[model samples]
Target: MKNWIINQSLDHPGRTVLISLILTFILGSGLRFFKVEDDMMKLLPQNMESRKTWDKVKEEFGNTEMIFIAFGKSGESIYEQTTLTSLWDFTAALEAIPDVEEVISMASMNRMDSEDGFLEINELLPNRELNVIQLEEIKTYLDNHPNVKNRVIGQHGDFLNVIVHPIDGAPNDILAGKLLDEADIYLGAYETHFGGAPYLTGVISELIRNDVMMLVRAGMVVMVLILLLNLRSVPAVGMVLSVIFLSLFAMTGSMGWIRGLTGSDKFLFTLMNTSMPIILLTIANSDGVHVLAKFFKKFRQTGDKREAVQKTMDALMLPIFLTSLTTAIAFLSLIFAPIEVMTGYGVSIAIGITWAWILSSLMLPSLIMMKSWNISSRALTSTSILERFANTIGKVVLQAPRKVLMSGLTIVVVGLAGIFWLNVEVNIQSFFKKGTKIRESLEF
Candidate 1:
């Protein structure tokens, strides 16, 4: 079987290629059923005190979607009757979004509009009564509360508050974008007075979405390119990506299966789906890089692509097997993470890494053998700095056995000692770099 994939790949590249495509399409389709969350509140931590305070404020008087609106006097003063009625209507319109919890401003304050009691505000303001005198008196009151004055006037002294909230149930970028979109339109009607989170959430959603998407996309591209660069053929990349795609599909499909078997509609693992692909890819990276590197190096030395493929597997099988085991073990280490996010990350990545390892060993090699190694591209060429460094290290280990062994032993001892101390000193805050977005948001 080790001899089969590389030795026989030249014989039936077509069939291998076809099967790979079919598998990819199936996997791609399967990934669609994966549901992403839309609730933004998940980004906030419940246990943290500052976040709790922020949440309390939101619960009391903030709309997660529509944040703020303002009214003020300028020129002759906003105390005029016309300005009062106009601002009241806009406030009423904003209260319409079902997800919206609250909106506040001087006009709204005077208007008596309500999320709980809309008809009451309507009666107070009336259909035609412009509450100019009342509004003027309110403007006078605002003068004393200068802290919120900018939260209402202007070129010289206007009101503004930068607001923040997790979009309700906005776990994914698309729906978060929708909430921001709706909020931005509201802001436009109310001008800068109502702006804050509208565009910000949209931008943040796009950034997080695009960043994650880029990582997954770029990883796939890089992995495929790495395969192609080594094997120098379409089929090599095809084989690797096929195996990866299959393993991921099978894993995700298992999720659907689990839900079906349990009769649960809510996918418990959904939160982990976004980064699971990348974690699997990261796990695949170590084995893929090593195996393919050795394969191509052998091919280069032998000048027989078939022999090279054979040598690649023959040389690396034990190491690759060890790598899979270690990778899975490394991921399992995440179980110790204190936070729930880290716990989910660890579990999913552990499964994914194991999946990648299995796919690499089981699927890619099998496909390679079935394909019989006929690809139309140049052979693996020139080693650059990394290969040289790897070679230098390999040579040092091989030539000086006693020294290498002692050094390796010492490193292991140190690593163990380090882990012991690390566990003692470990703090969750450290993994998150100093002043990270999560931290900054918390501080805000």
Candidate 2:
């Protein structure tokens, strides 16, 4: 099979490259359907006891998700007339937003009082503009009713909290955007912050999108620099990067395509998938580097590019295939994990590794055959610093096998001991730095 592929690629390099590009384009187009799954509960196994309970609660009652907004000016009491008026307007604006089922704030509360042996209930802030006496009466009522006061008022009267409940099935990202926009318009002069599970989930979705793009770009730049230093050829680095990117597109695009075809949320990208691109990039680069290194040596010996490609594939095909297979199988083990997200992560990454292997074996050889090389004498004869470093380690192992074994065992033992003291945190807020606005809002 390897020989057939190698011969076909060598026999018609242009046809091979064209076919690969066409396949890649068709798969890459599926990227248009990609989406991020931000609901943390969706990542858990559906059949788990806690997950089942949560689902049951939501089905029986209603949307339990809450978004908390806190707003006030520093050194200003929320009981002031202007502040109360602004709060009233803000609450009304929030209630007007679509999908918002309820908005709870002091402005929306009802006051109960006894008069002439009868109990009566009235709007807490009946009018948007409250005089000083009316504001004082509301403050006194809050002082008597600590539960209501604590829920709506912040510590030391520095701020007021508004709690919003969205209808079931409402999109969190859309609701969060609307809520923030209203806050900016209504409470623009005051200090406003937001925090809640729903809000954090939306924030996480954005962060994941940003991180995926940032990390992949950074990884590619670093890989290109490393490849240039080692391969010392612009064309060689380009060939390797092409394979890497195609494999990435195939993997990510397959997720979108699968979701579209199956109409299932199982394949949606999760926080766990943020590392997929970098992983595939490293593996694909490894295969390409091996092929190029071996081909360069063979070409130097035979002075024939075609012969070098054949000899390189003949020597490397089995070894590279086995390595990729073993790595994919290792990741495939995650299918047995209890978390649904881990299963998707495992399967998607395995697909990526397989794509990398295919491209490395087929498209890389075709690319090599098509590109004319001006291999420097130094590149053909001189060993790179990496090779020298590997050689030095090999000599140490050969000269002192017992010492190397003891060192390896000692390090493993230390790592095992450290596991006892490890602390695990699942809070999304913990992912951000202390000074970040999201982190501060969460803390507040």
Which one wins on TM-score? 2
Tell me the deviation in Å of residue 277 in model 2.
1.8
Off by over 4 Å in 2: 73-75, 117-119, 377-382, 391-406
User: In terms of lDDT, which candidate is strongest?
Assistant: 2
TM-score quality measure for candidate 1: 0.60
Candidate 1 lDDT, tens digit per residue, 1-444?
A: 654543434455556456654654554454444444333444444577876887788788654454433334323455555554555554555455454445454444443333765444333234434565765556665576566555544434333232333345433344334444553654443333233444334344444455567887999887766556555567666656655666666556544444445543333343334677676766666665566667656756776765666667777766777877777788668656544344445544565566666556545555555554433335455664557777899999889989999988999998888765655534323433455543332223
CA lDDT of each prediction against the hidden true structure: 0.53, 0.87
Tens digit of per-residue lDDT, candidate 2, span 104-130: 998888989999999999998889998
Q: Per the 3 Å backbone cut-off, how many clashing residue pairs does candidate 1 have?
A: 30
